[model samples]
Target chain A: MLKKILYSLTAVLILVSIYLVFFYAPIPVDPKSAGGDPENFKIFYFHLPIAISAYLAFAIVFVSSIMYLKTKKQEWDIVALSSAEVGVVFAFLTLATGSIWARSAWGAYWVTWDVRLNTSLVLFLIYISYLMVRQAVDEPEKRARLSAVFGIVGFLGVPLSFMSIRLWNKTTIHPVAELNYSTFSPLLTTLITNFAAFFLLMASLIIFRIGVEHLKEKGNEMKRKNSL
Target chain B: MKFLHIAWKDLKAEFRTKQMLNSMVMFSFLVIVIFSFAFGKESSIYISVIDRKIVDLLAPGMLWIAFTFAGMLGLSRSFAGEKEEGCLEGLKLCPVDRSDIYNGKVISNTVLMFLMEITTIPLFIVLFSYEIKNIPGLLLVVLLGTLGFIFVGTLLSALTVNTRTREILLPVILFPVLIPVILSAVTATGVLLAAGSIFEIAGELRILVIFDVIFFIVAQLVFEYTIED
Candidate 1:
């Protein structure tokens, strides 16, 4: 009951922080602009955090996979699945926001052969394959083990896919700048706060998903006992 | 000794059947031939407009494109044939190390891929009129790149061969995960074809070798778990 209350509180906080980002926080000026007064770049605050959050979700999948292999427990499998699902959601958001930003800045909606974009799409497909593989296999042990191996292999690609564009010297609209002290103003603070809220939201979702899996497991155990 | 026997058995079977090798090699040849007609004509245009190097530079990407697709076909069939024959279960029940099974599959897949590369390289040169001065370096890249593919492909093949949609799932699962290998291979190949100095291209080559080593170790370590019933 206490955990449920904490989850609810975190979910509410996430919504409130999102509201703050859209309405209360001052919009940032476009960094690429020259000479004019700063234009509202409020979307960047949301866009970047969501993207980073998605990558974090994938990292969770990777770690949980290792844990699952170590413990040979089903709980970690549940964690891995939930993270992949949530990671896919955030990854889609990243692509959508990225496309919107690209349109605003580059006057184009899409660019083929952009290595980063292509790899992200590939990552999404790979995760979808994970879910599909799980669904196709009837045996629980087989599903868990296969998905675990795939989760580890798929996460290994994350860094390589990200670096491929840079290595190939392909042009992408996404900015890759290091955050500095000067970049952290009032607007930046709100962005960081929003990021924290989203992170909390992700945690809450994973917890909820895990609860569902536990219930399913308990129900299966009871059914087996009753049959015997 | 026992592992080698199993591996040799697989190799002998592959040679006698020649199904996977023939399909892969044929597909690779068709791709190069089609590209020669479609893109080869435009090569001169690009050469006249850009530096003459563009044709050579694009050679690596073109070759990898063919190899990747053909390799996917080969990988999907790697374990499927065993599964179809009901031999995979017997192998799993064998007393030899699971890593040996992985190595055996990797070796056969590597051989099939190597043969495809051997057939395609000559065709690529003949069709593209590409100079063959750096034959040794290019062969080295092909060997390393093919190793990278076989390392990951063998694992993914095992993972997907039991699935309902094995054909579709292998590429979807394998390509994204092997981006590092593809990137490293393509870059190194491009550098070699462009006649870049060996020192200049060494970084990309090193990345390819490292990727091959890391994934090969990981796959071998994880194969037993993956094959568990």
Candidate 2:
């Protein structure tokens, strides 16, 4: 019942958020020199939420991974694996959309050493490697145990990646406002609404992915039984 | 410490076999040679050693490439003998904490990595025709940098050791984490080589120290997870 409500709420909220983002959010004048920044800055609304969603997904993966280690429960491993897969997808979306924003805003398709881009790329690579680690192991128990470690290690990356700015004292091209931009703008309501909607979407996506995993495992078990 | 004893055993084993030492040295040398040729063909006009402007730009990058790529070869194979002879299993079956095993490999790998660096530094100098203005500073960077690299690399090599495609996976996984270390190390070395003041490179050095400490503690903490089934 809760899951059904979440799914429907996500669908409605996302549709409303889309309308608000496109038609309602008052595009800001770049505080640095008025009339600066392209209207493509609209991408900020979508991009930031997606990026935070990916981090949230990773946070889930970290917790689920630790839970799996403590309990060795099959369900915990399932949750960790599902959340990581969802997180990676969100991460890629974050990258793809950010690059589109960059092309218009930064006047380049890519910037090699920019802190925000570089760190996100690293975060993406670490989880991709986490998934790859899962592929390389065959035994179910071993794969789960090993991937949990990788998952935990990979979370260390989130802070490291986010702290790249402070670590090197590099400037970011990403539009970070002096205050959290959400509060400053009239679009604040829409942004908060969108965040809540994305959170629901993430929860539904993870639960659905876990269902898929369980079904696949059952099918594998059936095949083994038939062969035996 | 039990970890020290395990490290001593690896050292003794390595001393008798000379396997890890020999392969790591040869690979490091070959890597330097390849870079020399590639730089000669590619970067010579742009970055000749006489032209300090570009020499400092490319040299640290080249040096670290040699260290890490050659280091990968050693790290990938560090557990080969144990894997094949079932020695790791024997070690696991023994009544000691598994992290001691991890710490032991960390010590041994660090020693081997330092050896590779010391041996290759002269080769890098000779090949690049680079004068070392700040030998101590450069060596200090190498020590701290390799300390960071080996902690993460050794932890990952252990994690990937049991997998079939580890040779390729080690770098794929290790390289990203190594970025901060590589950036700071290469930049610091570049500064030192350019005769930049010690104060100029201190920031990079501090970053390397921070990375080393963080990676070491994390590696030690998560090690048991990697060893368990």
Candidate 3:
């Protein structure tokens, strides 16, 4: 029942966010080019929230991974794996939406020199490789243990990777959006609403993914017993 | 003490065979030669006619690429060798903590990487006519960067050794985590090569040190899980 509520809530929030994003959010004037499309800025509402949600997903992976290592719980492994898979999807969405935003802002689909862009790229690659590590192992127990170790190691890199450009003192073309909380605006409302929507979506996806894994495990067990 | 014994055992075996060391050195040398040949046009004894500024720009990236690629070769072999005769099983059977095995591999891998690098740097200097402003700073950067690499690589080596596609997956998984190390090392090396003071590279050095320390400790803690049957 709670899962159904979560599912319905996520669906409603996502629809409301889409409406808010397309209709409610004020299109900002492009500061650089006077004639540039103001509509492109709308992608910001989706992009930043998705990126943050992806980070949240990986954070869950990190926590669950530690729990799996400590408690040796299969459920923690499920959470870690489910979160990682959803995180990778969200990471990919962040890149795609960010690319669309970049194409309009920078006149390129991709720019290599930007720190945030490259860091996101690296973060995406790291988790994809995490999934790859899972694929390369066949034994269930061994897979859980090995990927948990990688999940921990890989999460450690995320902060350093994001901080890399700043540490190197390189300039980034990516804009760091600062929210004005002093005055409540539609932009703020839209941004917060989108954040809620995307995070709930992530939660629903992970929960559903965990359920699938549970079913797969049961099927495997039944097969083993019947074979005997 | 047990870790030292494990390292010493690997070193003894390595020296007796000289197989991995020879291949690593040769591979790095070939990489440098190939890079210099591709980049330099007119050459004579002691100096190539390649623009000094261009060499400064290229040298750090070139040198580190050679080191990392060569390092990957050595790391992949580091654990794969144990898989051959169930040597890993025997190693795990020892009374020492599992992390000792991880430390031992880190030490041996670091030693082998340093040896390859020590030879490669001079060859690079002579080939590219590269001038070092601060050799000590460069060495520090190299040391910290190599530690970060080996710290993570050794753990992943053990982890991947258990997988079917052991060798191919190491670089795929290892390189993303290695971005900060490579970025800071190359930047610091570039700064040093261009005659900048070591203090100018303070940020990169700090990143390298922290990276080295974090991965070293983390890999030590998590390594036991990776090797478990």
The DockQ leader among the candidates is 3
- Candidate 1 pairs with clashing backbones: none
TM-scores for candidates 1 onward, in order: 0.90, 0.92, 0.96
lDDT of 1 by residue, B164-197 (tens): 6787878877876777778878988887777776
**Pairing residues by index, what is the TM-score of model 2?**
0.92
Task: Tell me the lDDT of model 3 at A1.
Answer: 98
RMSD of each: 3.0, 2.7, 2.0
TM-score result, candidate 3: 0.96
Per-residue lDDT over A56-106 for candidate 1, one digit per residue giving the tens place of the 0 to 100 score: 888998898888988998888999988888888888887887677666665
- Deviation in Å, model 1, residue A53 alpha carbon: 1.7
Model 3, A53-101: lDDT tens per residue?
9999999999999999999999999999999999999999999998888
Model 3 chain B: weakest 10-residue lDDT segment is B42-51
Q: Ten residues in a row with the worst lDDT in model 3 chain A?
A: A27-36
Q: Choose the strongest candidate by lDDT.
A: 3
Off by over 4 Å in 2: A31-37, A161-169, A179-185, A224-228, B41-51
Which runs of model 1 end up more than 4 angstroms from their true locations? A28-40, A111-119, A170-173, A176-184, A215-228, B43-57
Higher-scoring candidate on TM-score, 1 or 2: 2
Q: After superposition, how far is residue A91 of candidate 3 from its true place, in Å?
A: 0.5
- Looking at model 3, residue B90 earns an lDDT score of 93
